[model samples]
Every structure is written in C-alpha cells, then in structure tokens.
Target: MTKDTPPPPANTEQMNSPSFKLAVQDRDFLLSEPMRGVRFMLEYSKAQILLQRAKIRSTIVVFGSARFREGGPNKEPFWYEEARRFGRIASQLGGALCAEGGNHYHVIATGGGPGAMEAACRGAREVGAPAIGFNITLPHEQQPNPYTTPELTFNFHYFAMRKMHLAMRTKALVVFPGGFGTMDELFEILTLRQTGKVQSLPIVLFDEGYWREIVNFDALVKHGVIDSADLALFRFADRAETAWEALIEQGLDVSVGENDEDLARDM
Candidate 1:
C-alpha cells in the first residue's frame, strides 16, 4: 500500500454496528411483526396515562361524518350548528368545567377531523372546556381540527385501540348524520350495550328524519333480529336543547347552575 494512502482507522470498521444501537431508538425493530403486541399495549397505556393525568372522568363521544361542512350541502349547515351547540351544552351543564377537584365529566370527545367532529370540539372550546380528539393515522392523513385541546389530542395507529379508548370512558354518545365510519362507531357502542358489556347510557341521534330514512330500526324489530325492547337503547332529537333534555331524561347527572339560563332555550 502506498504511504499516501494511510491505513483505514480500526474504529471505523464497525460504523454500522447494531451492538451500539439503543433498542428504543430502533424504529425498524419496533415496527417489526414481533413487536405488534407491544405496539398495542403502548397505544392503550399512553392514552390511559394521559387521560388519567388530565382528570377526565367521563366523556361524551360525538360520532359523525367527516364529510359534512358548515354552510355546505343539504342540511350540513344545520347539522354542524346543532353539533356545536350540543358540545357547548354538554360542557356547560355536564360538570365538565365545574372544578370538583379536577373531576371533569362528560367532556366532549371526537374523531379529531373536520365537519361534525370539528363542530363538537368547537363547542367545547366555546365553554373553555378541555376536549379530546382520538385521531388515527390514515393514508391521506386526516388532520385534527384546531378546536381540540392540544394536550388531550392523541394519534392512534390501530382502529380497534382507538375505538376502545373512545368507548372506555364514554358516559354518553351523540351521533349525527354520517356514512360508513359513523355507522361503525354507532354500532360498536350499541353492540356493547346490547350484550351487557357496557352499562346503559344516553344515545342520542341528532336528526330523526335522516336516521329513519337511512336505518330501518323498525325493520330489524319486525324481522326478529333485534327485540322491540332494543329500540329503547337510543332516542332521537333534532335540536341541541332537545338533545340535552333527552340526555338528562336518560339519566345523565347534570348539575344546574344558578346562571344556567341558556339550557332552557332551544337552539
């Protein structure tokens, strides 16, 4: 070897060494098939810890179409406004901001996307209550809306885990007119309730007309698929105030404040 070409440094021989790697820093290893269970546990524990630390006692899950926009197509504007109003009503009256030693209940929670989800989060923001957004990573990347509380927002990789978190702490559910994703969420909760897996809670569908047109709950009863008593599982409302009343009738424990005159007004 030429003297000008100095011998390679001995330390440079293992520059790509795996032995020096930090296990936590290895993204490839973490994403490998063997780590799937670990990933699931991480998803559950991370959100559990954050929510517990935030003192979120109970949640009102708002499930709806991400396609609806304010001032958009037929009934979209109405749906948007009603959903927003519901969020505010729930936050204001459901002990969310009551400060009972950080025991916040019935705080709004959403899918962390636009349309109805944004409206619900926006409503919670109107009352200055902390709202949660359980966002999922998608191929096109559904962005979380600005209304979600920054500290409470979470991103999830698995749909099952995300749904689990949504259902776990939910004290009630308000479902607006939506498509496939909305149906899936609605049914998930309904199934949980029907099977005695989840305790009964308020399930309010925002638009009665739209829901009747799309889903034939009556037909299910006629066909003997679901018992007539199952119809008692959900109720319908067209306005935000009416929805709030329905929730109260369904056994939601809401403390009425002296200055809570707005709850009496229909939106």
Candidate 2:
C-alpha cells in the first residue's frame, strides 16, 4: 500500500461490537446518573413509543400458527379460515365492548406476522377499532403483514422485550392452534401468571377439540402432575363469543383505558 493508502480496519470478533459496548456503557451511565445519550437519535425508521406510564385498559393478544393456510384437512388448505375467524371474533368482541364504554377502548394486538396475525389486524380494521401489531425482524420466513394499523404497529429486535411489552399491556390472551413459536409465547405468559411474576390475566385456548386432543390438561390433573386448581389458570373456548364471555366472567372490562396514574402504578 502507498504511504497515503490506509489499511483495512481491524475486524473485532468479540461478541459485543464496539458500538454495542459503547451503547451498554452509555446506558449504565445514564442509569446511574441521567441525560447522557439523551440527544442520540435512534436510526430506526419507526421509534418505539415508551408508554410505560400509559394506562392501557384492555388488550387481547391472539396467537396461532403462521403456516396454516385457508382451508381444512377435507379441503387443500388449513389455518386460513381458522385464523380469519379467530381475528374476526376477537375484533368484534373488543370493538363492541369499547364502543359501549368510551376512549378507554379495547384493542386487538398481534405478533405482526402473517397468518393469524394478519387475520387479527384485519378483523380490528374491519370494525374501525385500533389494533397493534408487534413486529419483529426474524431470519426465518416471517414478515409483518400489511393489515396492521400503521400508527399502532411496533417493531422490536429483542424477543424478551417484545414479550415484556405483550405482557405489560395484555388483559387477555387467546391461543389458537400453532407451532413452537406460539407455544413459546403462550407458555411464557402462563408462567408469568402462574408464578405471580406478572398480574393475573385471562388466557383462553381456542378450539377446544384440537387443544383437548393434542394435550390433555385433565390427565395432568388426574395424574396429580399438576394441581387441579392450576387448571383454572386458563379457559378453553370453542368460539369467539365464548372467549369474550370468559373474560367478562372474570370481571374484566374490555374498554378500559390506562391513565397516567395507572401507568405509574404498574411501572
């Protein structure tokens, strides 16, 4: 290389990149003091709204398999109509309650991928209710569907953080037939509630037939593997109305909004 020519920059192989190291140190400094990197603007196309203190009345998170198609076993496709129905029902249930109440409205939120996520967002849009799609960039065949409300949609890099956000605002959970990802989300929430790490929230597994056949909760109870009382952790519903009724029976108001005070208390 000529004297004026520069050598290629050294590649740092350490797990924490130089930028990440600096970011962490900066964050630690801010935590101890304050106002350190306050001026550092994030390059994210959409900024995350940290509504930690915002009162959220009720949010329903719907989970299902992304690979399900539009028809059933008898047909050629599966999961398509099922996801659509799940979304449609959740939207109606949330919207009806919100309309009856006020701005403290119900919201339908999804994982922000296709399949059931799109169905949930589409259902909310169909009813003119606000919905949230929590998008995450994954290396696999996942992408945020176009049906999510632009203003309410959110993207995150951290699964734990995304899961935390889901738990933070969730009032209820509806689990549809899904794969490992769905189970991960579902069990995480269940463990949170079961361990009292988070507040008790309603969890409903839709499609009683499939759920019962796939996993036998009753057997768990019968075998004394788990306490029968623990079975009360979640409810099973065959349809949307049943799921809505289950939430209501728990003395939950779907249209409640969060106030500054409520948010502060939770935070």
Q: Which candidate is the best by TM-score?
A: 1
Tell me the whole-model lDDT of each prediction, alpha carbons only: 0.88, 0.66
lDDT of 2 by residue, 29-114 (tens): 54443542342222132333433222234467888877664544532143455455656666666542344335433467788887
lDDT, model 2, position 261: 61
Question: In model 1, how large is the Cα lDDT of residue 248?
Answer: 87
- Model 1, residue 172: C-alpha shift (Å): 0.3
How high a TM-score does candidate 2 get?
Answer: 0.71
What is the Å distance of residue 36 in model 1 from its true position?
0.7
Best by lDDT: 1
- Pairs in steric clash, model 2: 55-258, 56-258, 57-256, 69-78, 69-80, 70-80, 71-77, 104-255
**In model 1, which regions exceed 4 Å deviation?**
1-15, 255-267
* Model 1 lDDT per residue over 86-150, tens place: 99998998878966455677889999999999999999999989899999999999999999999
